[model samples]
Target: MTRGLVEDEKKEEETEKKAKKAAPAKPRKKATKKPAPKKRPDLEAHPTPEKEEKAPPKTEKSAETPPKIEKKPEEKPLEYKNDIVEVSVYHKPGCRIEMQIKASQDMVKEAHKKAIRTVSKQVNFPGFRKGKAPPEMILKNHPRDVDKSWQQVIADVAFKEAQSLAKVSLLD
Candidate 1:
C-alpha cells in the first residue's frame, strides 16, 4: 500500500509540471516618458516701434457737450411703531441687527393672566376638576410654574412684535 501511495503522489507532481509548461506566458508592457516643452523667446528683448496716427478733428457739437450727471432717489428712514411694545434697533457689522424691546405694563398683565390659565391646566386642586381650577387658586398654589409661563408668553409676544416692526423673518 505504501509503494502505491508514493507512486500516486509522484504522478500528481509530474501532471502539475506538465500543465504549467503548456500554459502561455503573458507579455509585459514597457514604461514610456513624456518629452520636455520648448522654451519661448522673451517679448521685452525685441520691442516693436508703435505707428503715430493723426487725431480726428472735434466738431462744435462734440466740443460744447457737457458730461451727464445722474441723480439717485433718496431713501426714507424706517419707523417702527407698536402700542404694546417699543423696539429700538441698532445696526451692527456684517449685516447684523440688534433689537431692544420694552413691553408695556398692559401687555405684561395680559401675559400674566394667560400664564395663570396655562399653569392651571397642568395642576389639580381639591373641590375642582383637573384643568378647571380658578386662576387665583392656580397662581396661589403654583407660583413658580405661573411665573415661568408668564416669562415664556412675554418673550413670545415681544419677539413677534419686533419681527413685525422690523419687517424681517425670524427663526424660532
Candidate 2:
C-alpha cells in the first residue's frame, strides 16, 4: 500500500510539469502615443494679399450728384451747484469725472462746533456727566479727537451736498 501511494504522487508531479511546458506564451502589444496637432498660421501677423478687380469708372450723372449731409444733435453740459461746498466738476474721457471741492468758512466753523460737541459726548470729564463736558475742556484735552471729528463732519456734509448737486450717487 505505501509503494502504491508514492507512485501516485510521482505521477501527479510529472503531469503538472508536462502541462506547464505544453502551454504557449502570449505576445505583448507595444505602447503607442497619439501624434501632436498641427499649428494654424497667423493671418494677422503675415497677411496674404489677393489681386483686387478695378470697378468701372463712375458716369457723369453719378459724379454730378451732391453728397448727403448729416446733422448731429447738440449736447448740453452738466451743471453742479452747492451752498456749503463749492464743487467744480470736469468730465473726462471714458465716462469718468473729476471734482474739486472747497468748503465755505461758515461750513468750517459749524463743523468745528459739531466736532467739539461730538467728542464731549463720547468722553467724560471731572465733575461732569458723559456728553456734558465743556467744549473748552474737551478742546484742551482732546485736540486730536476734535480735529478728526471736525474733518469727518466737514467731509460728510461736503460729500452729501456735492452728490445732490452733481446728481450722481456716491459710495461712502
Q: Per-prediction TM-score, please? A: 0.51, 0.51
TM-score of 2: 0.51
Query: Candidate 1 at 22: error in angstroms?
Result: 60
Task: Compute the lDDT for candidate 1.
Answer: 0.84
Whole-model lDDT values for every prediction: 0.84, 0.84
Candidate 2 achieves a global lDDT of: 0.84
C-alpha RMSD of each candidate structure in angstroms: 14.7, 13.9
Q: Please, what are the lDDT tens digits per residue for candidate 1 over residues 61-160? A: 8789976789665344345768888887766658777777889999999999999888888888889988899887887789999999999999999889
How far is 156's C-alpha from truth in model 1 (Å)?
0.3
Q: Model 2, range 76-145, lDDT digits (tens) per residue?
A: 4455655687787767668777777788898999999999999998998889999998888999999999
